[model samples]
Target: MGTFVNNAWYVAAWGNEVRRELLPRTLLGQQILLYRKENGEAVALVDRCPHKLAPLSLGELKGDSVQCGYHGLTFDCSGTCIRVPGQRNIPTEAQVRAFPVMEKYNAIWVWMGDPEQADTTAIIDVPHYGDPGWGLVDGQYLHFKSNYLNITDNLVDPAHTSYVHKNTIGNAAGEEVGVKVEQSDSHVLAYRWINDAPQVPLVERMGKLAGNVDRWQYYYLHLPSISYVDFGCIPVGTEPTEANKDRGFRSFSFNFLTPETESTTHYFWLHLRNYHPDDPQASDDVARLMNQTFEEDATLLEFIQREQERTGVREYARIAIDNAPLRIRRQIERLQSKEQSAEAAAMDCEAETAIR
Candidate 1:
């Protein structure tokens, strides 16, 4: 498994999931306690209590403070130990670590790295989120029994859709289409246009086109496992411009991937569409079809994960379609190295301070 970039903001749960009740979750192999204050502010903390390492989620919510059932080690939202049962003097070190958290775009995001460096601005921006004349289906979630990197690979590889998801969103028409890859500082995009072809099952059902159409599949993978798929179909021989694509039946599907463990992932997604902006039936169709499509990916990636773990190999060979996946892997390695070097330097600095 690749090293997780800890300094980034990861979605802990949907905004609705974190309420007045304490919710327990695991992110990047760490147990976390999430909840909302009485005033509606979201909060995150290490689940383990400092005294006995018991999970704080098992405790009761005393207003904004969590009172551990193990020993009544009550902690406030900032993870400061505010009260210790049967003791007038509270230990200075008796507190759980608080995680920086924020609620944005209908999700609660938590920072897993140094709290001093947490920045809410680092979170990605969702386009057309609240724009007029758009339909939104938000707060969707799924669980994947595979490494996150594997999902990242699948997200950028459109070739798999023809074989793995032929029934839902794929068709044999795109089997021969060539995919072009582009990379930037923070994202990798693998895109292609299947020109002058019959609409896939999804489009045929929703689009109701009269003749053959030109469709575009743009798979964008933002660094550290976020996916944005821009899918649409325009008229045959239509100018393939941004405005034209939007003019056609177009939708933006965003997938947020947060690692739950080395072999598990938390998948949060939202769908936005320009067509049928106010139709409840269209929202239902989008939800069902998208869920089915992602389930197909989840099933396949789980098998891939098992095989890879059994063989101790991530891949046996590389092919033409692996261009985007390979670039992401290299970029992850660079981040991993940079993090390790920073950690080592911090440790050395601590040692020097101790010597002084």
Candidate 2:
């Protein structure tokens, strides 16, 4: 089991994955059972039964409560013990821990931290989800053996795409256009400028966009667990340098990477855009093609994780293009420092209060 850093939220699963039936999931190394009540409300509780430590997931769902398969112990969504078959009354001490859970943008998010601090404010804002104009596509969920921090670093490093995904989205011979990186207390953004070049085979044949074009890609890391990529494209005839100011981009993608454990993560993504083929079937085909591109990324990352484990190494030397990852690591270290300071202050307060 891994230790969970308090005051963080994790993506448990897709909202659609949890139904009336109990669904077992592990987050931050804690086993949990999720289910929907009769009124369709989502609930999360520790998977262990208080009586015999039996997994509650294997138990049956009865109304808004779950019955332990071992001894018929029943618990409500809040982890309050409701019944013990053959007992005159349920013991007041019998209870299990329950975490705060919410369904947002088709994903179920759980607060794996202190219950008192769990609130909607902790969830990262995704503005594109409710917009009807943009065509939405389902993202992929994958498990990796590497630490969550490594995955975060990977996302922030745009240069890796060129080499790792060369067959897919990389630009093998593309120029190393300059990048602008900015970091604030809560967020980090990396902007990459791709100068004019002949379209790679994948983009030339499949992208369906023509003419001299320059691409500006911006990655925004919004603290804790969310990152979004904004892609901008300028046509051949347009002023390439001024395209970004002219709002030339028509597409954006947001990826919410949540840690299930130090060694595993859940990547929930939403691709939003207005560009689509006129033919309905063609649009579907395009969506499928785009999905396959992401699958390629997932497959590669999984292999990378396996290799990292076998080698037992840490800290890969970085290049100039890895500015995003460098910025993210600093941000994470800052947040962890703030957390420790806050905990120390609280401990001091408690000691003083007791003295009083």
Candidate 3:
């Protein structure tokens, strides 16, 4: 299982999680220490100290620098060794790697690859995040015992909802409706409208509709691994347009998947809803119900992950519904291949320049 795409922005933590105290986290299989400076700027460094390879997370924060607990080796936020207590001169090789980080949309994102290529503008936009007409439930987290690709596959597959989420977001009405797939250079969209269907339980409670409605599920998987469900229902036979969706009950469920290792992921999520924008109770209900819904997914995916490992088989068969998931997989492989090729070309260029 591929751990991650290095040259992408991955959510390192919620903005509030990083403070003056050291926060240890793993992303794309790299041990990282995250903390905020006095001015509230976030910093990320290779968690291991160059001296004795001790985890710098085990050390204490001193202003904007981290003092290694083992030998009092202090390093600044730039990962440069600043002070060696016993020796007046610091070793040139005593510095650790520092990752590029940016705080935006209430989350801290880190780039673990070539720091020079870190682009803050590449971060995906969250729609209506701070709008006055929307209610938000952010800072939710879940741990998954499955490869991120598995979670991505599940996100793009709407057919499983019929059986897997019967108690929460699922119903038997749209089980046979085939999902339509579309793709762009940076994302894939799998969507279908379930027309004239009874509103699901949660929607029934929250929506103003009193009968069957034309509901839409637009499952979007952004490049690498961010997934969000644009879901809601309008009055039966209403045109399933963006304006209608906004007029009716609508919510954007955002899931930010960050790989902690080959077989595990950090699931950070939030929900935005147009209904009950002023009701705190509604927000609480949405959080509880959504958390339960995701936990259901987490449990099943863990079982699938374990079985895949046990049998050494990723898939036994592919059905018609696998189109969207397969498209995403191909996209990811292409990205990885392209990144690898770029790195190879850069290495060759460096070698030739050295010979000169």
Candidate 4:
């Protein structure tokens, strides 16, 4: 029902959210218990106890193990059965599946599919993060009831900002501006050039310039369920001489949409730059602005998903702007097909090997 292939990283939560106390979080419709060890290493395990199906999150947290409240069954960080109360011997089969997890850039990512396929190679690279000169900002998570594909579609179309986000970052001038789009194997990049446009509400102004202003926007829909947007401004000053002009602004944001089920998604995000990571006041302001934008998108997508479900429409018409979403869906389909073919081939090889 959902497109969680065998080898992608899904953001579970912010690194700060998981503490010593075991917390229960739902991802891909599966409830999970998360906590950190005494040494501050985070661990994730299936929340349900194998013995009685009781939630492990409701149990007690020891130094490095979680004890199920129902039967005092204790499990370690690796999901291994460490202790069984009042029992002389522990069965070799008594264990819960442990998911591989890692923390990067202040967020925790979990592998939900095949353990053998999971690799650190799949983690996305954020070039601007930790760059000495650029500022880094803290990001937040948002929960949505819409299909993840719809969200990817929305990010690719900057044209919708003028209408859908009219009160926020949308400006009348943006709609009138000319845009050029280019395509690649994994992404679509669009740029808009505006000349002497008037400053509008909700949009950040880079001040008036005599020459043209370059606004670059790029969207990348990575396989499985990750998407990113890069937006920035390059201002050309009024004077013919380039002596007094200020350096322009640049920023990048990413969305990791982990499907909780067929109709639900967990949206994790990180807002980053080369300069802002240590500036508390600036980071707080940026966080507030980014949260507002996410709220707007989440509200609209939720309503759209509900309507589509109610109507039971199979084929909905799309416009030219929907190109990125269509491209992403095609890529996902290809990956799924390839995986199935590989599995079938492996099975056939095994059959022959057995006969020999």
Could you say which candidate leads in lDDT? 3
- Off-target runs (Cα >4 Å) in candidate 2 are 1-5, 173-175, 200-208, 237-249, 277-291, 303-312, 340-356
Clash pairs (backbone) in predicted model 3: none
The residue ranges of model 3 lying beyond 4 angstroms of the native Cα positions read: 1-3
- Colliding residue pairs in candidate 4: 28-260, 29-260, 134-274, 134-275, 135-274, 135-275, 135-276, 136-276, 136-277
lDDT of 1 by residue, 42-93 (tens): 9999998999999999999999999998999999999999999898999998
How close is every model to the real structure, measured as TM-score? 0.98, 0.85, 0.98, 0.85
What C-alpha lDDT do the candidate models reach, one value each? Answer: 0.90, 0.72, 0.91, 0.72
TM-score, structure 1 vs. true: 0.98
Q: After superposition, how far is residue 227 of candidate 3 from its true place, in Å?
A: 0.5
lDDT (10s digit) by residue, model 4, range 1-356: 34546557788888999999988888777898889889988899999988889999989998899999999999988888988999878888779989999899888889877688888777888866777666666557888888887777777777777677665556566776554556565455544544455433322532323334444456666667777766554554344222222235456778888887777888888776432446776567667777788889989988888988899872478766666667777777776677778888989999999999
Query: In candidate 3, what are the lDDT values of residues 1-356, reduced to their tens digit?
Result: 37478888999999999999999999999999999999999999999999899999999999999999899899999999999997799899999899999898899999988888898999988999999999999999999999999999999988888888777777889898999999998999998888898888788778677889888889999989999899899998888778988999999999999999989999999999999988999999999999988999999999999999999998999998899989998999898888889999999999999999
> How close is each model in CA RMSD to the real structure?
1.2, 3.3, 1.1, 3.8
In terms of lDDT, model 2 sits at 0.72
Off by over 4 Å in 1: none
Window of ten residues with lowest summed lDDT in model 3: 1-10
